[model samples]
Target: MEKNNLYPVFLKTAQLEILIVGGGFVAEEKLHFLTKSSPDAQITLVAPLIREGTAEKAKAFQVHLVRASYHAGYLQGKHLVIACTDKPQVNEKIYQDCRLRNILVNVADNPPLCDFYMGGIVTKGHVKIAISTNGKSPTTAKRLRQFFEEILPEDISWMVENLNRFRKTLKGDFESKVHKMNEVTQHLITNKN
Candidate 1:
């Protein structure tokens, strides 16, 4: 069997126990992503000294800020871990520790140690588009995301709501449902209006 790499997924982070092992700018950047991606994500930062805006962002996003250094024990209850300290050795150690326990981990800016890459995302209400370059170029992913964000209309959420309602009313097998949904949604693409 071929190993399927980089399976993209949107996680419900609200109930997850997430840990970040740093308090500097690197940690702040990671925090920005998490807070934006999953606003209610259960995040805990294990850093001795947080930067100025880190606390504000944490507060805005409801992150748990711990004024302490990273420790292996901190990894015990985390569903996902991000190692973002200035020390490469510390990040590598965190990655290894996560590996030993079969946990998903990402060492910031270190692709080799990352189990997953946080790709660019465009979201409008219930609709979301995730873009990835298989960890090659994040800039491209970011550009694509911006383009999508521009093209996708604000009222598109209305269509999404209608389609969801229609989907709930659908009663058929998988293929039949797909056919019906396609038939219903085809006009949105084909119509020049």
Candidate 2:
């Protein structure tokens, strides 16, 4: 049986600089999801012709638009890169450039060339869930994300906040605190059936 070996992590995009090569629909899609997940992410888009919708969306976020062709120089000072240009050669070049600079790169729709996959993400206040299909089926991941969004309680964050407040008031060793916390939250997983 095949299993996914990819590790999942959450990044603080606000602290990292991101570069996207191209301004087509794929680029726009990437930009939309990135901003939706991390509103404070600093991003730069370089393309000779940017779509009007993409440009308009940039106005609402901290996104810089460089109306020019992509070059290796654009990779400078960038922590992450996304290549989604209409030209396969240009996108491949972007990927190669990113590799040389030790920057993480994702080549849109090309799983083999991508260093990372942007999975479906569901965010509810402080609670966030990321779903991945190991770069195999993104549509399946999207459906799972929608399912989770519907099943999760809207007040889940409030419960988290209250637990945190209660945790701070407890004075004990780390192990004891963990045990007590587990006991308190055990009911959350109780099987009623």
Candidate 3:
């Protein structure tokens, strides 16, 4: 039997060391996504020949572009790694290396091999929503992102600011503060007015 089990959580990518292996269209696409979503992500790309536009994007994003083929040593010190090379054998080697080292890795387009799936993310000020179709369909996740983008309130930033202000004024220990905040924002989760 197959499993669609995945645990979702947001990572602080700004401080993480990310490594990408590949330089073709797949690599370019992954890099583009990271550059926009994780602007501060420290990414090192290991590729012999980057596809067109990749250099420009890498320069713009300040990615450490390493002009070389894939090697196991590149995985050192990396918190998250993405394998998107054009050659299946190279990608498999990288994946196997990551597995041996017990590192979190994602092998693009191969759901069975990936440790994590990059879901469609919709970010608005203080509100960020991640949409996933259990790695079954990225298209569905993307459409849901568009749907959420339209429905999300524009004053969400204001709501967050006010909530923060309220929390600051409260006098309590950590647990009490959490309880008070949960009381205020519980409706958002339960969908009750």
User: For candidate 2, lDDT tens digit of each residue in 24-74?
Assistant: 899899999999999999999999999999998887895999999999999
lDDT of 3 by residue, 27-88 (tens): 88889877767788899988999876887788888899999988899998999999998888
Best by lDDT: 2
lDDT of each: 0.88, 0.94, 0.88
Segments in model 3 whose C-alpha atoms lie over 4 Å from true places: 1-4, 173-176, 186-193
Q: Which ten residues in a row have the lowest lDDT in candidate 1?
A: 1-10
Q: How many backbone clashes does candidate 1 have?
A: 0
Worst 10 residues of 3 by lDDT: 184-193
Off by over 4 Å in 2: none
Q: Which portions of model 1 miss their true places by more than 4 Å? A: 1-5, 191-193
Q: Alpha carbon lDDT of residue 90, candidate 2?
A: 91
Clashes of each: 0, 0, 0
